[model samples]
Every structure is written in structure tokens, then in C-alpha cells.
Target: MSTRAMLFACWIVTFGMVAATVACAPAPVPVDERRPDPGTVVGSPRRLASYPALYTSTSRAERVEYSSRGPAGEPTVVSGALLVPRGEPPPDGWPIVSYAHAGDGGDPACAPSLSPDLRGALDELLGLVSRGYVVVATDYQRSSARGPHPYLDVASSSANLVDAARAAVASVPGASNRWFAVGVSQGGHAAWAANERATDSELRLLGSVSLAPQLDMTDVATDAARGSLSPERVVLFPTLVDGASSTDPSVVPDNLYRGTLSRRTDAAAPCLGDSGAVGTDDARAVPAADYAPATDEDRVRLTAALDARRLPRSPATAPALVAFGGRDSVTSPERTRAAVRAACARGDRVTVLERPDDDHRVGISPEVLDWITALRSGATPRPTCGPEPTSPTSTGPE
Candidate 1:
């Protein structure tokens, strides 16, 4: 080879080697002097798979949408809002509280709305967040495009709530693994259900709070049958009956003559939301006792389920705070007390508080507030229930 060609080849080899060395070199360490603030690290923005595109606005609090893997390859998407403190992040993993709303599948669109009349109850969400705890509220199954809310599908909804919390921690900055689950009315049922079924490895659930929970469907239906019940309560019974019957066929009468069975079966099918041709108003007009399967048969089935105690059987490994209104006619406090006792027997750290004067709609009472404060401060709450005097109160509609 010519001397010039040999020299050029050598130079090319050297350049290639240098390029490779530079490419493989470790990156310079970030300046220690500019290390990220601990608070910032805790509050940094994060993304997780299955989370919906986050929505933020000057007038409204930020919102997130996300999906979770469900049983049997069924993936369900849930939408929720993450309420952070106004200016700074909490020092430790911020305590988290997940709020489950009550009744007829709440509307997710109202999550960030500012109007008090609408879903914009920023105070509730922001209150906890401002107090150094992240607040997450899910739209659950029905709130989004996801159909088949499965309103009473205790296991499914509970799982969705848990998965949403996990997703929130992944997506929100400075979120902590410690969490509390709370719900009122229908939501109260959800809180209890989630606690019963939650796994230790999946959530470090610090506590669960249930307010005026609908504990025994059988009791509620019986009350409605004996007298004039609220249209809402009356309408909800059939759905519960249908769900229970679907899960356990024995809940329905086996010896009912074929004609009677057909009539009752037809009435129960098509679920509340999916009852096509029959309008919501029409469905609501049907009295609980007037349904096809004789009221006695329906009652028999529901009573059996309650006697069998088919509620989520998983024991709550974390502490639980159960509150009920003394005057809650919608859901019997007696039943709630029984549930609290059961939770205690299951070895859960349990606290039961009954506000003698409060009704179903009043938000948390002073005693309940004190209990929450104590829990957040790391005090282990003990179960307590009694007839305390009613206090003045106001809470938004369920």
C-alpha cells in the first residue's frame, strides 16, 4: 500500500476508537450543590401505564384518567383527581386518602368542577391534600365510558379502587405508600369491601373509614316493604337483588312453579342501567314489593345471603374507623355496629364511632374528625360506639 493511504487508514482507525470511547464513557455526576430538594423529589411529576391524560386548569384542580388490569383479562379504566397542597410538598411520603362517593354511580365530570352545586367539592379533596396528605377520588366503573358499573359488584369495585390508588402513587409527585380509604353511604359499603379484600403486599392501608354504610340489603328492603320508602332506596333494591341472585342461584327459589320463576326472572334481568325500553322513571315506579317474584321469595333470598354473611370475607389487616349516624333511617346503624364487631373479631385494629345526632347526609362529625387526626398522628384507634347527643351539621347530598 502507498505510504499516504496507510497513514490515512491509521488516522481513521484512531478516530473510530476515540468515538467509541467517548460514547461509552459514564456521564458526569450531577452537581451535589444542585441536588434536588427533598420536597421536589417527593412532588415530582410521574407517569404510569393505564393512567389517562392529566387535565389541569387555572380555575380547577388537576385531574387524572387511568386504567387498571382486571380479573380474567378484563381491563377497566378509572378517572380520578390528585389534590396536592397549594405550594409545598410534604416531607415524608405524604399520607394519602382515597374518597369513595355514594349512590347511583357518581359523575366523574364533576370531579374538578368548581361550582359547589356541581361535582366541584374542592374543599374535601384539597382539605386533605393541604394537610400534607395526597387526596385521590375515583369515578369508579360507571362514571367513565366503561359500561356495566356493576354497582354492587363488591370485589370488582374494591379492586378498582386499590388499583387506582397504586396508579395515583406512580403518577403523582411525592405520593406516599401509606393510604386511608373512606366512603359514605354506597361509598361506605365500598370502603368496607375494599378493606376486607385488600392484600398486605398491594397496599399499606393505614386505615378505612365508613360513614352510614348500607350494611344489610335485606334489612333495607324489609323496611321499604313495610312502609313508604324513598324512591331512590326503593329503586336500588331490585338491582341489589338481581346482583345477589346472579352470584348465587340458590338465592332464588328453586321450587317456584315455572311460571312464577319466569316472571320474576324476567323482571330481574336487564339490570337497572341496562333495562332497555323501560325508562329509568318507569323502573323506579315499580315498587320493591310489587316485583314479579313474590316479595316473600325475594325477602327469603336476601335474608339467606345476610345470614350466610356473604359480604367480602377478607379480613382487614389495617386499622379501621367506622362511623354511623344515630338517626340514619336509610341504613340501619345496628347492622353497621355488627359489621364493626365482625371486623374487630377478624383481628383488625378497629375504632367505631356513632354520632347520636347526625343523619346520613351530614359529613364527618367532630368526634370523627378527632379520630382521623389521631390516626394521622400515629395513634392506634380503639373501637367505641354509643348514643352521643346530636350536633348541628351540614354535608352535601349523596
Candidate 2:
């Protein structure tokens, strides 16, 4: 076995021993207020088939099954990764970066922990881990659970993101409870929502970095149902319908797709880059128009779910750095800007990064890193909300 694999084995055995000892020891009648809860680790972090090879700066990268609350407030298990830096941690422990990845279809196989490649946000995560920040990325319950992935359900996914941090602190030897959230696209919405949800957890949320978050899915879902969704975003229709089906029984494959596309066994078959039902394969070929709801009631049911998941569900729990691209077809720029405005109006300190020429794929750069570094150094971020053409900290196209 490799050294990393051996280390993982040792951690599992040691953790098991500690757990057994704690279980056997007598406990006080009352809970101890002075001691902070170390959070919940559902199972020991095990060695993944692929580990640190993708993250050169990481000394240890392992897959962990962590505890989280589901949509209806029930206990659930989710999958995630814990990436430790290359050297010894600071006295307080290594500060954490809880990452939320974009939608990768509803399939468990699309999970980042299962794949060797980080995908989409590799460079950003690589930079942070290289700079000594421990990183944890949640696959959300949908990726690891028994049902279709709730594509944009911020509440549940954000809980998973924050709980991933809790699990890291409970499981990783030197992982600090101090943490921040970072995400892109769907993940961006998750990160922003996690910022609000983190206040309830034991972990300290310093801030969040959100890139191209899909704030209000209601408009987009409505567009898809009405056959008015922009061509650029039509590829996402299947996933949206699948996600809507996860929450509402009324929305199904047969009523949402045409002919063979509706006949496919796997309703949620598209895996991010693959155009499952929206492509030109004769077996299941169809135009974007074919992907439509059977009735107006189906559209209403889908829209209701999307509306409930809108961002700023409550005022943000921490200051944030939100970057929005003008040309983002997947997430409406107008809606994102509106959400940010609403958050600002609600007394949240949000620093905006408006890149007018960029698209849905916003590049992570040094500026974003500098902002995170400033927060770590105890610098207060200046809020950027004043006028219509808001003055953002970073206005240049990225």
C-alpha cells in the first residue's frame, strides 16, 4: 500500500478507538457549555481510488461520508472530500475553505469525490490548498443519496456544505473550525446560502465568494416551460426538469420530454457536459422545444419549488464577495444583480465583482484570492451598494 493509504488506515483505526473510549466513558448529567461541539462525522474518511495526484499541493485527500439534514429536516448522509495542506498546521489548526461545486447532473457518478479530476473549479481550489488552507468539498445529498440531485435547492445543499466543514473539524486532526465558502454557478448559490446557514453551525464563517450564482430559478424554469428559454441555456432543461421532479411528483419525464427522450429509463441521465435528451442522437434525439411541461400545472409546480430556493432566503450571515458576469446565460445577470441589491438593502455587507463581458464561466483570479487573504488578516470588506450602476471592488471583465 502507498504511504497515503497507510495513513488513511491508521486514521480510521485511531478514530475508531477514540470513539469506543468516548462511548464507554461516563458522562455528566448536564451538557458542557464550555466545550464547543466538534460537529458530526457519519463515518471515518476512507482512502479514495484517486487522491492527491490531482492536487499537487495537498498532502492528504480522502473521501468522507458526513452527516447532514435533508429537505424535510430528517438526518441524511452526504459524500465529500477533505484536502489537507502539505505542512504542519498553525497552532489553532489549518483554516478551512468549504467548496461547493456546480451541478454535475443528478448521478452519483458525477460527484467530484468519485472522480480523479476536480473539474470546473480546479485552479481555484489548487491555489487555496497550495497556500496552506485545508479544503472540503461536499457532493450534496443528491449526489450521494438515493434520489435525484436537487439541482438548485440552496437550503439543503448549503446545509451539506456547512456540515462538510463540521465533519472536517470532527475528522481531520488539525482542521480548524474557522472556515469560508466558495462556489461557482449552482455552487455559487449554495455558497451564498451556506453563508446564511453557517451561523447556526459551530463553524465560524468568515465570508463567502460566489461566482455567477443562480439566484432566482423561477424565471428560468418558467422560460423553459414556456419554450422561451434562450438557446444557450436549453442544454440545462433536462436537469432542471429532473430536479423539479425530485421535489414534485407532478413533474415527470414522460410529460416533460418527447418520444424517445421520454422513454429513457433514467430520467436524470444528462451528466453536465453530455447533452442527454437535448442532442441529435436518433435514438433519443429532440429539439429544445420537445423538452416542455405537459401542462400549466406542471410549470406551476416547478416554479414554486424554484421560487422557494431563491437566494437571500434570509439576510446573509456573514460579509460576502459576489461576482456576476453580464453574459451569463445559465444564471440571469439581472436576477443576480437584483438579489445582490436586495441583500445590500437588508443591511448585509456584500462586495460586488461585476465583470460585464464575461459569461457563466467566471475565471477565478488573484483578486478573489486577495479578498480572501484580506478577510483572513482581519480586514473588513467595504460594502459596495450605493447607486444604480453600483461601484464594485472589481469591475474589469475577467
Backbone clash count, each prediction separately: 6, 0
Distance (Å) between predicted and true CA of 266, model 1? 16
Give the per-residue Cα lDDT of candidate 2 at 137.
Answer: 87
Which residue ranges in model 2 land beyond 4 Å of their true spot?
Answer: 1-39, 143-146, 259-270, 274-288, 386-398
Q: What tens-digit string does per-residue lDDT give for candidate 1 at 143-237?
A: 22232234455765576567667765766667777788887776777777778766847457766787777765556445544645454454454
What lDDT is obtained when candidate 1 is compared to the true structure? 0.51
Measured against the true structure, the TM-scores of the candidates, in listed sequence, are: 0.64, 0.81
Number of the predicted model whose lDDT against the real structure is largest? 2
Residue 1 Cα positional deviation in candidate 1, in Å, after optimal superposition: 86
Candidate 1: stretches off by over 4 Å? 1-60, 69-73, 105-121, 143-147, 200-202, 221-232, 238-312, 385-398
Q: Could you say which candidate leads in TM-score?
A: 2
- Cα deviation at 236, candidate 2, in Å, is 1.5
Model 2: colliding residue pairs: none
